[model samples]
Structures are given as C-alpha cells and as structure tokens.
Target: MKRTLVIGDIHGGLKALIQVLERAKVTTDDTLIFLGDYIDGWSESAQTIQYLIELSEKQECIFIKGNHDVWCEDYLRIGKANRTWLFHGGALTFEGYQQLSDEEKKKHLNFFERMKLYYVDDNNNLFIHAGYTSMKGPEQEFYKSNYNWDRTLWEMVLTMDKRVKKHSVLYPKRLKIYNEIYIGHTPTLYYNIETPMNAINVWNIDTGAAFTGKLTVLDVNTKQYWQSDNVNELYPNEKGRN
Candidate 1:
C-alpha cells in the first residue's frame, strides 16, 4: 500500500530534508504533504526550494504555506526584506537567494505563490501550516493569518485532551470536524519533545528543524514516523534560527 507522508517544517535544512526522505524510503507512489516553512534558518533555503520544485515534477506533493514562507515570498516579490523576518532567520534565506538569477527568482516566487494555506483530504484529514480559529473549518476562518500563526488549536487540544471526552458536549467542535489534523508552525521542541507530538487528533509534526531538533516525516495513516539527525548536528558551524 502507498503511504501518505506528512512532512514537518524544513527551515532550510536541505540536508535534513534529504536525509528524512531517504530514511523514510519515499517513492513516487507515496503522496507527500509538506507543512511549509520551507525556507529560513539554515544556509540552504534557496537550494531547498529548488529541490522541492524538482521533487514535485514527478512525485505527488501538496504544499501548505507557513508564516516564514510568507516572508520569503514577500521579499522575492517586492525586493525588500522585512526587519522582523531578518530577526527570525530571514537573513539566511536572503543570503541564499543572492546567488540566484532573476529568472530563477521568479520561478521560486511562483512556487511560493502557488502554496495553499490549508487543505482537507477526501478522508476529512486537515493539513494546515498552523491552527485556525473557526469552529466550522478553516474555510470559515475570517483572518487568514490564523492559518499561518495561530497556536490556540493545539493549546486547546493539549489542555482538553484529558479533561473532556470527545463525545461530551463540552468537547471542542473544531476538533470534531476532521478525522485528523496535522500542523507545523509551533515546534514540538518547545514542549521539549524531540519527535512529533499528538493531542487528540491533532498531530504537531514540527520537530524544530529550524532550531536544535530534527526533521520528521509521518505516514499519516500508519502513524509511523521517520526523523533526521538533529539539524544543529547537521550544521555545527551555523546557528540555525537560534
């Protein structure tokens, strides 16, 4: 049977990304769903995007946009760097793009332009970069920023998982909408977790490749996961989004 692999935040660690794919034994038959933040942090952000563009040509892939991705896209389109972005790993991404030609930049920009904020599969599994506020669904969400920035969804699940029964009237209706929901903006590392973390049906796959943790790939159906060596270990000389 084919696997539907859900990938976590990359944060420009192309080596870690490649390692996880190899460790997972990914093939064209597998469907890859990336939770975004493809760039920023490490020194290889531009090269990472190039690899993904090539990877998608033959493999089945779905890309969701994250907050860091938005910053990269903005810089590529407007040619002005955000000071806030620079503080949070954008400087590395800016430097990575410096060597690329204008045509290549446009192609990369187009790739970012095509990213989706959220996607719901036939099985009602939600793949979003971050949490949403809408009780109905992400489509019902008014502020699109929540799709890239909110942490309340995960926070709620963590707080309520043991307190409320899923069938209880007090259980979160938002969690009831999907069979499973996968997200990446908030790192599992923040919770001192080195692997994917789960509360109820929400899976937090961001193992913090942007910082000191590893990159992870999850088989959405089997819940079997593979991880790369710590990104900090991969680039000892570079401080990755520290």
Candidate 2:
C-alpha cells in the first residue's frame, strides 16, 4: 500500500536518516515529507543535502524549510555566515560544504532555494517545518518566518485543556482548521521523550538527532512510526549541536 510518511528534523545526521528510511521499509510507493533542518549538526550536512537531491529523483518528496535551513540558504547566497547560526551547528554545515566544488555548491544552493514553507494535502493534513501563528491557515500567515520559527502552536496544543471541546470557543481556531498538523523543529527529546509525540491533532516528529536523540519517521495516517539509534552514537567523534 502507498503511504505518506512525515519525517523529523535531520540535523545533518545522514546515517540516522538512512536507518529510519530502511527501518520503515520505504519504497517508491511512499511519499516522503521531510520536516527540514536538513543541515547544521552532524558531519554529513552537505552530503545529506546531496543525498536528498538524488533521492527526490526516485520518489515523491516534499521539503519544508526549517530555521536552520534558512541559515544555510543565507550563507550560500550571501557568503557570510551568521554568528548565531554558527554557534548552533552552522559551523559543521559550513565545513562540510568546503569539500564541494563551486558548481556542486551552486546546485545545492538551488536545492535549498526550492524548499517550501508549508504543505497542505488533499485530506487537509498540514505539514510544516515549524509552527505557524495564523488562525486562518498558513497561506494567510502575516509573518512568513513563523512558518519556520514559531513554537507557540506546539506549546499551545501541548498545554491545551483536555476538557475543551473542538467546537468550543475556548478551543484553538488554529487546531480546528486541519484534520492533523505535522511539524519538526521542536524535538520530542526536549521533553525527554525520544519518540514521536501527538498532542491533540498536532504531531511533533523531531526526535532531536541534533543532540543525543534519534531520527524519526511516522506513517501519517496510521501514526505507526520508526526511529533510528541515538545519532550521537553514529558519529562519536563529532559533537552534534550538543
């Protein structure tokens, strides 16, 4: 059966990304929706982007832009690295790109340039790298950065009162618009949960591959998921945004 799989943040851990893909037995029949942050932490930041570029040739894939991706794209375009971004894993990503030729770098930059802020499916399923703030929908969002930086949507749902009904005015209008919302910027490991998390209709897939956490992939409809081993363990010699 064909399946739509939503993947968590990669943070440049290509090994873990490969592991979860294999663990989930992914095939061309599967549609992979990566929740971005494809680069920044691990040693394979550049290689991971190249891999994704190649992978798209074999299957249906949608790439959502994450905050880290923004940083990478900016560096590629302007040739100036942001100090704040470098402190948070951008250093390794930049170092990784040093190995690529000018032409390869240009190709990779094009790849980043094409990333989407958000994607909505025929079933009204929302897929975004981070959270959006607009109540109407991502399309009507006033602040475009919120698509790749907002955390309030996740936090609100995380703390939402369980007693509130979906139809109640007390319930969030944001949550009412979609059948389900999937995001990745906020890692589940931040809360000490090393797996995918679901709060109300929102699914948080980022398992923190940037730190000591695993990479994750979930079947959007069934909620059945697969995860990789701790990413730090895969590249012990490198400190991955820890």
What TM-score does each of the candidates earn?
0.98, 0.98
How big is the positional error of residue 85 in model 1, measured in Å on the Cα after superposition? Answer: 0.6
Runs off by more than 4 Å, candidate 1 = 161-163
Q: Compose the digit string of candidate 2's lDDT tens values, residues 1-242.
A: 99999999999999999998999999999999999899999999998999999999999999999999999999988889999999999999989888889899899889999999899998999999888888898888999999999999999999988899899999899889999999999988789999999898999999999999999999998989999999999999998998
Give Cα-based local distance difference scores for all models.
0.95, 0.93
Model 2 lDDT on a 0 to 1 scale: 0.93
Deviating ranges (above 4 Å) for candidate 2:
none
lDDT of 1 by residue, 22-73 (tens): 9999999999999999999999999999999999998999999999999999
How does candidate 2 fare on TM-score?
0.98
